[model samples]
Target: METTSKGTEDKGISRARFLAGAAALGLAGAVLPATGAQAADARAGRAGRPGRGLTRRGVVYTVGAGETPGTAWDPARMRADVRSIRHDLHANTVDVTGDGVERLTATAAEAAERDLHVWLQPTLGDVPQRDILEHLAECGRFADRLRGQGASVELSVGCEFWLFVPGIVPGETVLERIENLQNGTADPEQVQRRLTAFTAKAAAVGRSVFGGRLGYAAAQDDEVDWSLFDVVGIDYYSYHEHPADYVRELRRYLRWGKPLAITEFGTCTYAGAPQAGGMGWSVVDYDKDPPEIKGNLVRSERTQAAYLTDLLSVFESMGLYGAMAFEFLSADAPHRPDDPLHDLDMASYALTKPIRDRPDDPASPWHWEPKDAFHALSRRYARTC
Candidate 1:
């Protein structure tokens, strides 16, 4: 997920957690060589032979998709969620992401164990290139191990590093860097050059450890050199940036002749969220005591449902490799009926609405009711090839 105005990236990971994650993955400071059998499939990174290029029908499941969710270690809860994504959503692949290597590896391993093609994505925000590279190295090694277990896996090296990596843009922080990019204060060519340099280094790092296909999830304006990546993934929001034809907009990446995937795409649950694009969550006054919706916004599951189904159809028509819905659950954002001000789920892109406790069902502590969007996606994906 991109570091938005909400400061999800600032959740700061502990050194112990990172090291524990490294040890969990058997990362003993040595990059292993790929097996001779591993080279059977080339660009698509499939098993034994080259298969259909873009077969990942999926959803992007962040360990904690929202900033508040990821660090909570709950395998039973997470595994159940993964099962739902595979069985309920009918998705063949899952683009698993989050900052902590331990959580990233744990969540991705769960997906892989469920026989879902795991897209292991490591993300760290507002860090130096060195820190990002280190995160990538850890992920690459773990992904390589996962593939070695005979699972279909890919290591998407890093994400929007130009925005996350410091010193590339003039902004001291990610928000400042983004501001420079938006205001046209940052040099386009300079940004591209530096980004390219960092990506090249990242690709080299990936190849050194991971035998599987590698990629990066680019932001809307990123000028990625696709030659270094096997799959072209974008954090594509349907009406974001007011693009005339999203299919036409997506075709720009097809020029590279690489398989494409929508790394992340989903709108909030408000009335006009379909058009708000990435800023849909801005309606909430996060600084408030209880975090209330700023305006008198009407929550519409129908709007969310229709938007998702329509976009899935659009992506299918375009013959995409895959388009991962932004998320499966937003645990921290619970649904509060008749309370729009505190109904944080209105701003969440999750297919399932989370609830703190179900009054009637004491047997199940935390229960999530599938919204119309969830079933809409399931019906669409169930019918998909």
Candidate 2:
């Protein structure tokens, strides 16, 4: 669920394919508003409070780069997207992901306008492990700026370190690491050790520059040193390996005795997608010229809606701090109902499909159509838990 726009195509496509397969805020006791200035005021009230109630009912707002240039980061598009998430999707928070400081800043400002609390993550695509701190330091600078403006933001130093950042894992590239993983050649313990060591350093630097909450987005199976963070964040995708024990799996995190948040969760728009879960998108052939499904495929928006509703129910039952759906939109995977080969949206996990052409009407500001998950989440978020 954590991705960067500027990532290499091979790396990007590997992720897109893997993702075709698979897929926070703290406030202890404050009630949240559905929207408007009141929501902003409510979040402002819990900016740094420890005992505040769950405030991160969120959806990730993303714009990717590389082959899918349609989804590349744009300030104007970000503004419109943030607004839709606030007024239309009914999310009170957003986890904004982008490559550089400027993009993250633009995203943060727009989220603030919509009264959304944020988890700001830098997309550290191919940065060497030695220099990762520099990127995170930029994030700290942005965090300081936003905090000055009274925005509720958490600085995530990095995500899925083993795959994204070099040196921590066996390979210099993500695809290499992924191959190592698939072949069972990569050692999980070794990856965890390096990640822990690097995160300790990142936490120290992040704490010095930004005075608010700080956390790292760890993969579900990777154990992190929770002492390094104020909040325990995990990018969990429910492949539903053990439905009956799902809550039990999450409960183990409470041993950290910190606020736990599901940093990412959701599936693609296709029949049996919920069953495919995190691995749904990975089913596509990345080697194909334009990336197509390996065999027969069926598109079903409802499958995605079901995935969101089911996961949200589990999150609410777990009584965890908060959760964000994997994403609000994917700009690159434009919808093409006219041509099956060009209909790349079947591989996308976004809540809405990007429109190939904008309508001539000024009234029609949106460039995408809401899928079933959008309505499902909007209705769910409209209610108070």
Candidate 3:
């Protein structure tokens, strides 16, 4: 039982006009509508023309996490950060976390004040199947709040279900849990049906708020019922078999005739680390006490930069919508000094140093500063907008 909004029916040709305008401007691969009615109004602002001012280059933004008062959503900090990013990287969008919806709204308001776009990444935490329907209903209410404020959200990153399942539970156990979870609450025969209905309902909320521009973030191979989303959202962490391979995979998604967004992508760049295969595949921690016998891969700053350059080049050449870096700032989590694997923790993946106090020793991985990959991305994005 999904419903379409009135604005969607009247905006059919508007979407086409925007895509055509992007294609005409040499941005031929993917076309993403900027968020909110302001973008639409911006289109209308161009001399009362019905179909102009659309661009192929999709909006670019940084990801912000954590609940830190000033670091996460301070208006002054957001303005300064957005101003710096625009100056140094041409990124115009800020993807704020869902739990911080009020803070995000405030940040978005600041962004709007500064003439920047704000994309809210809503999080649907792990829920028992019995609560699925209720959760979705609550999501609808949240979307209504955004709409009432005259704000539009870009993507509603639904449940990170994969992380909960295979990451924690074993193989067959995971499948059984899914079945039990669904059956315990709803009709067993309608599990898939309910899931699809729920996904569509959530997406509809986004479309209602954002005038039909919406997407979801998912694992690379996660099988999402396509009826729920308008674009392909995939996360690629270690898929850099080669530069052409990246292009090939992205092109594969384009064959679906929908825009693609690389919601998460990055490499560890450390040697002797085990990489996780696709979704549902077991993870192989290279630093395990009894290391699993697998292919050894070496990651370095130079390699990271090369991989990024190739991917970005392919994205730009194909005129795909746009891509966001995995993160903006380093995680504030502290690293454990006694453990070898501590160097590979979440904090290590940051492009910048942590604000928290740590050992000043040079031998610590925390001692590593921004590598060439950071500057490479900064340079490319800075020049693009």
Candidate 1 Cα misplacement greater than 4 A, ranges: 1-54, 64-73, 180-185, 240-244, 358-365
Tens digit of per-residue lDDT, candidate 2, span 1-385: 3343323442455346434332211111111112354334333431122334345788876644534444456678778889988888888889887566677778887898778888887656666765667878887888878988898888888777766777776776665666566556767667667867877888888888889998877766565677989988887765574543566557666665788888878888888776655555555665676556655678888888987887777777666788888778776566777666656778777889876664222222337889999999999887753
The predicted structure with the larger TM-score, 2 or 3, is 2
Error of 1 at 51 (Å): 17
Pairs of residues at least 3 apart in sequence or in different chains that clash in candidate 3: 89-382, 269-299
Compared with the true structure, model 3 gives a TM-score of: 0.59
- Report the CA-based lDDT of candidate 3 relative to the real structure: 0.42
lDDT of each: 0.71, 0.69, 0.42
lDDT of 3 by residue, 218-329 (tens): 5554445555677666655545556555555555455445666665555433432213212101112334532221233333556556655666676666666556554444
Which pairs of residues collide in candidate 1? 54-321
Report the error of model 3 at residue 324, Å: 1.2
Using alpha carbons, what is the TM-score of model 1? 0.81
Candidate 3, residue 299: Cα displacement in angstroms equals 7.9
**Candidate order by decreasing lDDT:** 1, 2, 3
Better lDDT candidate (1, 2): 1
* Per-candidate total of colliding backbone pairs: 1, 21, 2
